[model samples]
Target: MEARLKKTECVKQAPLAQILPPVILGGAGFSYQVYPDPNISQVRQVLRQAFNLGLRAIDTSPYYEPSEELIGQAISEPDFANRYPRDQYIIMTKVGRLGADRFDYSPSWVRCSVNRSLERLHVDYLDVVFCHDIEYVTEEAALDAIGILLEFVREGKVRYIGASSYRIDLLLQLAQSVLDRYGRPLDVVQNWAQMTLQNNRLETDGLKNFRDLGISCVCNASPLTLGLLRSNGVPVGSLGDFHPAPAALRTAALRAADYVAEQGESLAALALRYAIWRARATSTSDFQVSTITGIGSTKELDENISAISQILLPTHGSPINSARVERDAPLWNKVQEILGSWLNFNFTSPEANWDVQQQKFVKLKL
Candidate 1:
C-alpha cells in the first residue's frame, strides 16, 4: 500500500499537457510526397493506423497528392464512420490554391474547392475550412472568397472558418475586415513553429499582435525540425528525401542536430513534443502526419504518442513565474550568431521586392 502511494506520487510530477490531452494529430499522410507513389492501398493502411492511434484531428489540403480521394476511401470503408463518428474528429482542409501550385481567390473557386474537398473526404461538410496561404491575397479579395465559405458555414456545411499562416499584415486585415464587414472574428491561424526556437516572421513580424486579438494558432513545421535534431546524433538517414534545402541550410541543420543531441532525448520525439509544450499556453500545435510520406510509421506514432503522454502526466512545482524571462534566450542568440553570415542575400517578396536584411540562415530551399 505504501509502495502504491509512492508510485502514484512519482507519476504526479510532470507537465500535464504532455501526458493528458490527446495531442491534436496532424494528418497530411495520404498525400504527403514522402512516399514513392501513394495509392489507395497505402492510403487505407495509413488511415487505419491513424485512427487506431487515437488521432482526433486530421488536416489535409487538395494540393496534397490524392489526399482527398484517399481520405474518402478510408472514411467510406466498412464501419469506419460508425466507429468514429464524424463529430468525434476535427478535419481541417484549405482552399485558395487553385491551378497547379498557384493560389486563387475567386469566389467561384471557393465554392468549387469546398465541394471538391467534401467529395474527396467522403463528407457533406468540413469541420473547419481554412483560407490556405493567404499571404499574397488582398483583404477585399480574401473577404470575397471567405464570403462563400461563410455561407457554407451558415448553411451548416462548414463548422468554422480560419486561415493558415497568412502574412501578418494580411492576418490583421482579414480579422478586421471580418468584424467590420461581416461582424465576426476568424476562428484560427496556422503558422510554422518548431523546437529550433526561431520565429523568423512569427516573432519579428506581427504574429504576437494577431494572437492578442483572440485567434487560436495551429503550429506546423514541428517535426521537420525534429528531423534536423536526429541527423546529427542518430545517423538516421531516412529524412534524406524529405530534406529540400541548399548546402547552407543543410549545414545549419547539422548544427541543429548537434544542439538537439546535447539535450538527451530522441531529436524526432523531442521536436514533435516540444511544440505542444511551448504552444500549450497559446493554441494547439498541429502534428503533420503523412501516410504517404512514411517518415512516421505506426511504430513512430506509438513512440511519439507515448512520449507526449508521459510528458503530460502531472506536476507540482515551484510557482510558474509567468514573468520569467524568455526561454533559451542564450541559445537563440547563438543561432543568430552562427547563421548571421548565411542570410546575406537580396530577394523580393512574392508580394513585393524590398531591400531586406536577414541575420539568420536563409532557407532558400523551402
Candidate 2:
C-alpha cells in the first residue's frame, strides 16, 4: 500500500506558510477513549493508516498520555518514514502542561516542553508549536508563554508558533502582541471547528478574524462533533476537556442528524466534508484534522478524498454539496449563544479577498 501511494500524486500543493494543510489527522484520545485499551501494534496501525491516507498533519499534546511516543514509534518504521518527506507533513505539538501541574505558560516550562516533545517525537525541530489551553493561564503568563515560543523560533527548533483554545479577542490580542514585540503576527491558530455548528464562535468571528490577519488555523475536535450531531450526540469523553457536549447540544445534534439523513446522506460524511469545505470556502488558509479513523485504509482514503473534492467543486446555486446539505443544518445560532459577544467582529466580507477590518473600526453589519 505504501509503495503504491509512493507512486501516486497523493499530496495536493498549496501555499505552505500561508495555507494551513488540510487533513491534519489527530492521534490523541483514540486508543484510550475511542478504541479502549488497544495494544501498541494497534496504535501503530492507526497512525500508519492515517499517513497512508495522505493525511500530512498530526496534532498531539502531552496531555494525551503516550500519544506522542506512539506516533514516534509508528513513524520511525523505515517503510513509513521513507514514504513521505518529514517536512512534507506538518507535526504540531503543544506545550504548557506537565503531569497534573496545570498548564504553564512560562518561558521555563515552554522550553522544557519543546525539548521534551522533541525527545518524545524523535525529531530535531517542530513544524509548529502552540500554547495549549491558555484559557486557564493568566494574561501575563500567556505573554510569557509566547515569549518562550519566540525563543524556540530564534533557536530554529520550532518553525512557527501559535495559540490553542483561545477566544477570538485573545487570539487577536496575541497576534497584535506578537507583532508589536516580535515584528510578526502568529503563524497559526488552533481552534475547535466542525460542520454541524458545535462552535459558532469560530465561524462567526474567530475563524474569519484569523484569516483576516493572514493566520492559518488548525481545526480540533472536527469529527467527534459529528457524533454530537448524531442522535446519541458526541460523548463528552470523545470531545476532550473544554466545552463537553451537553444535553442541549446533544438534542440539537440529533435534530441535525435526522435532518441530514432525511436528505439522503450519511451524517459522518457531512461532518468531515463540512469541516474542511467551510474552512476553504472562507479562505482561512487551510483546515486541519486530528484523527482520520473514518479514513485509514487506501480505499477509505480514496473515498474521503473524493468526498472532499466533490464538496469543493461547483454545483451551481447550491450552497453546499448535496451530501453536506442533506446531512446537517447550520448551527450558527446555537453557536452564537454559546460563544455570545465573542462572535461579534467584522471578518465576514464580500468574499473577493480575505480582508478583515479590525474590531474597533469595523461596525457590526449583522
Q: RMSD (Cα, Å) of candidate 1? A: 10.1
lDDT of 2 at 362: 30
Stretches > 4 Å off in candidate 1: 1-22, 194-196, 200-208, 216-246, 258-264, 283-296, 314-366
lDDT of 2 by residue, 294-364 (tens): 32234444555665656654433543465644434453344334433333222221222312221112344
- Looking at candidate 2, what is the lDDT of residue 121? 85
The lDDT of model 2 is 0.56
Q: Provide backbone clash counts, one per model.
A: 9, 9
* Each prediction's whole-model lDDT (CA): 0.53, 0.56
User: How many Å off is the CA of 330 in candidate 1?
Assistant: 11
State how far residue 197 of model 2 sits from its true place (Å). Answer: 2.9
| Candidate 2 TM-score to native | 0.72
Model 1 scores a C-alpha lDDT of 0.53
